[model samples]
Target: MRQANGDVRVGGPVNNRDVAEAHNYHAATKHSYWSVRLGGHFLDWANKPHPHKVYQGLPVVPLPCDVTPPTMAALEAVAAFPSMGTSIRNLAELAQVLFFCGGLTKKKVYPGGEAQYFRAASCTGGLYEIEIYAVCGDLPGLSAGVYHFCPADFALRRLRAGDLRGELARATADEESISDAPVILVLTAIFWRNAWKYQARAYRHFYWDAGTILANLLATAAATQLASRIVAGFIDTRVDRLLGLDSEREGSLCLVPIGAHSPAAEPSEVLPIAPETVPLSKREVDYPLITQIRAASMLLSEEEVRVWRSGFAPSPPPPINRKCFPLNTIKRDALPNRTLGEVIIRRGSTRQFAQLPISFRQLSTILERSSRGIPADFLGGSGTTLLDTYLVVNSVENLPTGAFYYSPSEQALELLKEGTFRRKAGYLCLEQGLGIEASVIIFFLADLDRILERYGNRGYGAAQLEAGIVGGKIYLCAYALGLGATGTTFYDDDVTEFFSPHAAGKAALFAVAIGHSARVPGRVKLLAPGAR
Candidate 1:
């Protein structure tokens, strides 16, 4: 049974043991050249959970079938961070945003009875563990309720039928963005779905995968003219209970409140809900570390939530007395005319990158545009970021091969060291061939010690989430400019060592490789099911 405050009656309180467990897990999951070889973990294909969630009894509300293409330019969408403006208003706009961000975009078939369903954002191990749920107030073509987005069917299954935005507002400690929003999207991760392949480290994938999806969601909202803000600091129990999630298996990761200008809904009673869901697989394996980390990071009380949401100032960039190579970016007018929707539909992770160089303009455009910062409550304000980006350049016209740190504030790359290190790049990225083959590798590093001190363990999630969002934008921009990009796993400490003493104390959060793809034309179709 669920309580009025939205806590499921679990056995006992999670305590210091849980926090210790999470810490141990993080230490254990770090990949070293030797650790990877010794682990001997293999994918258990036979027990793979169904990628889609199915609710048996809920009424299905199909989103508009004919979604119009957004007219916002791809680059503009990546850079747009609107606040307190237009609302989503109707079902069509909502559908457009949802489809572009998380809908099933394509189906791929491999030789030996293997088929993969790909979405707009790239996922590690191609395991789609993230799930999207919408909690909203009444609007055109829909009613107030909590609904689960069924991507396979392009519909939402109503889980609880009522205006539940108030519960969310409370969960977030009345964060202005959420209280004023007409619609809130909660992204959750199913542990076993990803852990089957990633093992204990699947906990990290939870935020990485969700971050990529948020990247698309934020851009799509911007393209459709809806103001969006991410709410990462919330009462975890209240949210999980509000969504009827079993905290042990599935839990809320982050919340996105879409639209603006609506008055805060009056507080209302949230009734108990125990919706029946189809089993993801015949059986499920439990990962205690996942539950422990989530519980440890959770803000237990509304007061705690409010205090946590106050936010912290990121450490200022190191003194810039040296010569900074300013990026030569293309003007907005000269950017490709492709719309964000069109680019997302055609976007895919590059499986194989050609050993050719991309123009400096292309690389500069991505850096200059995507680093504008995200609009979120945890960031304290727009134009602030929790992570810093560094790069290893193997090939780019007019730029020497070397290691550099991207100073977004100066719109320049601070050259740290100069020389070819493609082999080292390949080694740092967990020995992936994509590292050496791609034209350049971007590494997102953060000062975890400072972040954790300021925001506690939850800051770890915030940093990883922000990195994934920025990396995802790079994917869209790369595809928009006829280049290819793919996210990669890395040897964490080794990455810091490679870019030392500049990146010395920072921890590597995420990495992406960008260049031209070696695949044949038309081998993988990127168009939506019925589009020109």
Candidate 2:
């Protein structure tokens, strides 16, 4: 599978057009320490794209204002993966889920005409590029239709007023979860929205940003007793066409089926749609690589989607001779008092950590609970994951400062090397101070050789996305315990090397820092009354 330029050749038996495209894109966009420094990329603030997507001709159906706030304890919500027996039968339940996933949560104004709007989850560069749409059957208060969620107005714009879930089910190859779903949420990304800042790398954020939002959405659904699972394998063009998307500028990324209902409506005639949308920017710069990668990863037909969804099981890691310190986790009954909704409303990326030691129990709870795994189509089963976690202990009580590997199978941490690597941790994380001061810096890595060999290039996205979802959970988990956490960028190669021998041949996928905040301020309440 190796190519001349060191790019993995993704054209074997399971490898298809999409796989090859992903490989080419990945090879071209990789970041080396020197490559990033010499790129000389500069942000053009004047050309920044509009954050919110608006449809001009559609009549809006205002969602129900009465949303039931979630009361489930934060840790319980993180650990809960309710069965598909539960259903979201009303508009109120749907409204609550959407609000917590993407609704505006906090607003702040700064001097010099600057303002920042925070959402339910964090995004890179604070650039909200992901847009959500819903396809569903008739519910208690909502009629069957295809609708776009407008976060700016908190309304759903009717794009096509009819049950379109059948089309989506077909697009996903009649995947049981989507076919049984009363409502399916389609997430898309507008290339220029984030590309304006990160350029071609924005492609990765397509999954990262969406994954973070999914973390919140999944938890919110579970808290409300609605069954939910993320569906990543689908016919990309079919989904885009169903949503009337112009694939050049914007494209579909994933489908999330929420709640269970009766069998899917019989496949219906898909009508042609070309709704007028407000232009995002005066001028937009096109990144060819982004489009190329998206096209390459797309499964072209329902048959192809079916074949693609036959995901491979990742091989278990090689055995190691090391003492494993099993996690000492608190039971659900003994979890912190704060609810998941409450924690999300107050969660923010820690700007500065106070170099203080956190209890070993706090760190262990985060690992044990968040690592229970996510419910997604790509994963083989519940509690199964594509990424392995590694941590650098900086200041956790009862834990010696060192680099360690977290064994999810054993629910324990295996000591890799014992030493004071605070300075090395900071350097690996691009010299960020948070890396040195945090109680623990967690890194998510994966064996790309095995991943790509088994699932092909699409597995690349599956790996990074799972990392973000897990990382986002860690963010919420830390906040529930009254500690602070933040996701950070890192020198990827350096991370694998820092945890070398144990993390040998594994590629770094994501990183998050957990610690006490330097400043403790009251959380700003932004939800409407009774709206969590």
Candidate 3:
């Protein structure tokens, strides 16, 4: 399953010659035509690769030792460490980073008595395929080595001996971030794990789920005053080998360098070691298309990596005259005053939305705050949005319950179609009730044809990142407003269909439901950095 270089195709036959051959300018129209005329083959769910990757008859080694859980408040408070110039003096800091990023956040029991442990961030389908490994020098409490984080036991299992951070730096062409940081967090996704439920498109989930976790991590790092950036361009195989991951089952997705100004890491003198990890699930499943797509989009040469690192292909000029709203401006005092720390600690995806209505002011503030310019190189300028926003208004004061397109250009909602489609909303979101019950559901739709033609595979990264940045902001905004929100997976075609004519030709990027939660005051824990 390992390719000599990263040259795998992403979408395979779905976005191939025949599909691309169609001159479909409007995605919603194209989607509607396919669903109504072709009997539902356009947005292919049948081909969704399995979401979980199961391995059987494997070794299960307990992590070296038990580690203490970091103080929740301390964990949440230190979003960026180096910003404060605080040195990481001992082994405890490393443990804090590992646990906070990947530790279990909560547990729940089902009617059948089965227990499910949720993680630090909400994931689509709660299917977590992302895995984290550490590469660093020996610190205060532990030895220098490559180790995989086992969230179940809250311990680290050594995968290789000694410092391999230099090898990683070289693999990334000495990506400056990795070279200077004391510890680098390497993230990889097990193909079959998420592919099982989402199928080939699980490839996107690799980044979507990852982006959410990265949001938490970045925020946590920011609270700590540590400089962190997401690095995608690198020699894939070299990093895979260093981590001893079976390229067939899992591969490196991104690398995050944390902390600054420690002694330079020395490369390991020992040859590459391939130690075995115990099997995680019962039986291994295969998703060839997903593997194929991931491999195709991979970066091979340092030249290709460098070439693909930047540049958005020539985007078609914006419409000479399309009527869209300029995003509404907000008064500073009217905005939610909760600090970033308070918001993150209290945030959780809404499971049930009260039919009770949210105030027009609260809703307006969220739309404004979440749409504010994101800080990204891909964004031409601050406040630039890569994707358009559309909404299904179930209920809002002074607003009709129908489908509306957010003309950020006009800062007003353009009524696309006037109809109550609560049932349609639920169906579009894989039949989730939250969509129907929420005050309004926001859907991010992108012009992928333009994006891909301009940025290639990296465009997908930028789009998802933008959605995540805003989505993360949405979480903060909602919590600060005393509302609730949750990120969700949706039926691609149905969303476009619901917003049709207006949303034609656009592809679904991300979905989040905002409303109210059902938990009691103290039921949901809220801890910030340094808090217990």
Candidate 4:
């Protein structure tokens, strides 16, 4: 038995040349009417994995307590990106970025004193399985080292003692942004932490969970005046080894470099060290499919990474002169005055939604801010997003009750059909009222065939992560406008069919519902940042 990324498991790596494994894994994990009803999986509360990663007996580096978060308006922040060559930041600013990206925001106490400590970004099932690490050169108030961010206690523990940005450069094949960056943020996922609930499907959630955190990080970075870019192509084994990660238990998802214009370090020896870690649960169950898929998607060498990175090539362009509604964003003065930090603290998954209507301008504003473009490697220039947003409009002022297509580059909404879809919307979203009662539901659809062709098996993760990021941005935009929003799983094929013809050959990646909150009292107490 072999596993993905060369792990010891019950299967061999999926062959990328034929794309058989990519298609099979996606098809196997899809939710259908019968699949949801007959799938016998159940949560084992006794063995629920702990969310935090705790390393035993390590020196703690406490971040600055008085660091102030960026005060830019949330909407503005979403559209903001710093010019890459000019920005330089210190420790205090870095502290602020880490906090806003994954910091402890509030405590929600349910009945019987059951409590859930929510972080800055929204996560699926509130399982904070995504872990953030920073590798940096010496900066003001901080030293050069590889460090892991511990959100539970609001501090960092040095994982390796020395500057390793040069090592990151080598792993990424000297990606421009990464090579010159003062700091690189590496995001990884702990399998059992989420697999305890989602099983084999938890692999996809790795990127989804990280995507939400990234949405926050990008917005906060923009507001913090720090330039950042997402580097998706990297040698998996090298990066995992550099952080001393046990690749069987955890693997790097993506590398994000911050700031620039510094000299790139030459690659040095990468020694191995394994520090003991607190066990996540009393017992852990291995999901062989995850291991297999991970191994299949990995780039084994620098030459392979170079080829993978180069394949981002050009994505297809959108239709020209198509009849589309030109987006009408709310004037800056009328938009939310709330800052990025305030919006993040106030944001949460809306439980119930009212049938109240939201204005078209609000929807327009969301598209405008979120569509400015993600500074990412997978996306090439204009109209290169792997995902396309489709909407189920149930209750929106001046918009018909039907499905629609959104063109980010054109900044327009093209109506797919004009008819009531509330009942159909509910049925599609795994039968949830969150879909039926919302002002609009945004569904991200991607050409998996094209993505896989361009990015290899690993492109599967990239597509899913991109959806999660956009879904996250929609959440922030809705919250900034005092609306409720939630991410949901849907009957994958049904979504494609519902918006068919226009959505032909495209697969659904993720979905989000936005509208007025029902505000069911006492379910979970809300905590605003200033008061919390």
Candidate 5:
């Protein structure tokens, strides 16, 4: 019964021969009319998961808040590589990266006295399930230890007191890129936090949410002149053991090594321990589907990780020889003058988009800025990505109203079937007004067959995560230009069908709507803060 989209049976360990768990999970989670009509899922507000995870009885190490905010232009900062020839000199600089990446940037108190803390990265359901931890050799102003970043109070809680980069390097198949780094940041997700709202589908958010933070993490690192890269191919259980996490309830997602100077690290020695924790809720409901798919995606051994990373060569799809609209983006000198830290602080998902047209330059700038390429382990080699961008242009300065495919190589939009598709665009995005009202909606589609064949079910997670990263970049780019943006869910099969032949075998992974915010009239003006 593995027909996908509807009839598919996925059970037991997923092998290379049977890589249908991702297909099944993707199919099972599709948001179609029939599925939504029949599947009744409701939020249990009384049992909501706590917003923060606190380690009981650990000494608090407050991070410095006076770290200088990065002054580089947000567009150039987000678009450039983190290969700068500089290093993280002290904890304040690292704190700058951490704060911009995951720390709370602003707090809003509602009239009801309920205080809401907005984090740097955009999270699903505002449920911040992702957690950040650091493992490092000794560095200025900080010691060699394993510490969890407590964003609630802007502090670190030490979990182990020793250098563990060697252990981390080994868990990542001796990835040499991170060997000389003074610090490595590990991202993990606690199951119950997001599952409280999304159920089994929360597994997908593990990466989607992290991808947003990573978008900021990479940009901030580059702005701070630190070299960094995302390592996704690591021994899952080993990393979990390193973090001393309860494997089923919480697990590692990826590791990022920052800076390039450090001494050799000692091997990790983690004892069997479950540190005490504050309860997240009065009770937690278990989602077996999450565990099932997470297991299906796990790499059992270090050698397996190496092999998986080695085989991550997904043959590029057929090239787009037919370039349609030539892209005209802003010149480097004319790019936005806003600092990344300032844009991050002011950024919020646009809840209301004005029914207006954004200049062609703005549209092209966002595309060019976000598609420069992402730096992650799964995406080996230069400019490698699994998802292709498709667009439904509703209103723009000079562009025609139609659906088109974005060719990063050609720097052009391949004209798919052209015509006004506002109604169709809204329907594809689950009948949301935001999709219809926005000047344009961007859809990310991935070739699951090719990706799964190369990296097994785990590639599914990477694809979603990558989409999130690109969407996150689009979000930041929009805000930097004094516009607004928001992420939206789509009707999977319908999106693929709308772009036929060109998008035939692709799976719809993510979508984002971008345009001017309604709160401000015509076009909002942004202040350019002077950078250091």
Candidate 6:
């Protein structure tokens, strides 16, 4: 294994109880909540990390702007989750998928005169660290090879000049899905990108942010009728080397096989390329803690991948001893059929929302879609839930606004209390006003104690990934309804308390705000040449 500063040995199989305790202690004492506040004040946003990956004098191609695919037809939202079979297997379709999933969506001029461009998913610190690469067989227009997605120009730059899905399939130890996939999406995170703001915890945000993006990718693929699955357990270094990424600086997170094929692919001639890449920022500042936690959880071999992937087990429900609230259930057809594409196009982090009451039906639709079973490898085959969802209902028609617990099994919202928590909601989300402005805020709480104890250090990976998948789905669902949604960070303990007895000991995993957006006049175009 490539050694780096602060790297820990996360190289073994651990049970659930041990993993859970490690996570709990890490969150409570070792890393602790209070440490974050102090750390935040010390951060230098002015001296924030730079964006460009400085290739210096390396010969690089400026991908064409025409690489972006046009947005597709919006399909109505369906309650039942369908496993997509085929897709728009063309260059244009591929470009569209890439753009919608990772392209720059909008640009805003900060009051300080800084123009910040946002992407398809809501990132923790808006640090676009996660990079996407494509490995495929010959398609409609593009060639068969490995290509890096250049979001700046919305194009792909060829790296390896031959079909390499076979190599990936082999690296993944002949995982059936990859063996039959026409295209595979590889997601890798550049550490310093997000760690600039969140420091060590930013490692987790890598999964969180990427998960949200994957959510968009999966939903869009489904709309196009493409088959895709999240493959978290893989030979990390092998895939990293295939993409020619510096494993210490940027590491592969997950692999997604898009579109199905009848026959398996043959392995490519694996050549080792140690081409020197660019530095992400002008002068690099290192954060040891981030690397330590990441290294502790890295999976080294194909056998290890299989072990980690199979070792996962769903978190057991909280003991039935506590008094649970009654829930509000709705019919499946009551949901709208807004095509997933339409939702993604119109979707944005609700920068501003009218605190107007949304109909209870809207709330019901979001809950239904967000919690619908997700297809993932870590999920243990049975739509298993790795995180618990709790909500701070700010306002909704006929629903008393307060905190509540979502029972996916019951398909209902169990009322935990009845009152307004707009201010508390905002406060809990580190004072981001979006929380208070949103109609409903959903918080993902995981029993880290139980999870880590069962899965070991790697449990952290499953928990974050699960939250991201669900959170990402909720984003699409909100947009499908013509509403808006954005992922937000929160004060872990405060969230549990705000939800009270129902969520007392549970730690906050992730959060999202759902509501009507303050519509911008004229469809705001993003990434238009010279438009900024």
So what's the TM-score on candidate 4? Answer: 0.94
At residue 189, what lDDT does model 2 achieve?
90
How many pairs collide in each candidate, listed in order?
A: 0, 1, 68, 2, 0, 21
**Any runs in candidate 1 off by more than 4 Å, and if so which?**
1-23, 111-114, 321-323, 520-522, 526-532
How much does candidate 5 score in TM-score?
A: 0.93
How many collisions between residues are there in candidate 5? Answer: 0
What TM-score goes with each of the models? 0.94, 0.93, 0.76, 0.94, 0.93, 0.86
| CA error at residue 526 for candidate 5, angstroms | 15
- lDDT: which is higher, 3 or 6? 6
**Compared with the true structure, what per-residue lDDT tens digits does model 2 show for residues 1-532?**
0111222334433334435565556657766678689877788778678889989979888887666668888888887775454888888888888888888777655555456677888887888999999998999989998999987777899988878798888889899999999999999998889988877878887888888898888889888888889899888878998899989989998899888965668868987799999888888877776766666666777777777668667677656578667788766677788988888888888888999999888999999878887888888777788898999999988888898899888778888889998898888888889898888999999987777666667778878889889888998899999999998878877888888887888888889999999974434446552333
| Candidate 6 ranges with C-alpha deviation above 4 Å | 1-37, 40-47, 52-84, 109-114, 262-264, 311-338, 518-524, 527-532
**Alpha carbon lDDT of residue 314, candidate 1?**
73
Write model 3 residue lDDT over 304-327, tens digit each, in one string.
565655644334423424433343
lDDT per residue for candidate 1 within 1-532, as digits (tens), equals 1111211224565532244434455666789988898887766667788888888888999888788877799889888886646887988877887888888787766656466678878899888999999998898998998999988888988988878888888888888889888889999998888987877678889888998898888888888778898889888888998899888888898999889776557767766677888888766766565666677788887887877778778778886565578999988788998988888888888888899999999999999888887887778676688887899999999999999998887888988899999999999988889999999999999887777767777877888889889999899889889899999999988999988899898888899999998884433445453231
lDDT of 6 by residue, 121-151 (tens): 6677678888898888888777787888766
Q: Per-prediction RMSD in angstroms?
A: 4.3, 3.9, 6.7, 2.9, 4.2, 4.2
lDDT of 2: 0.82
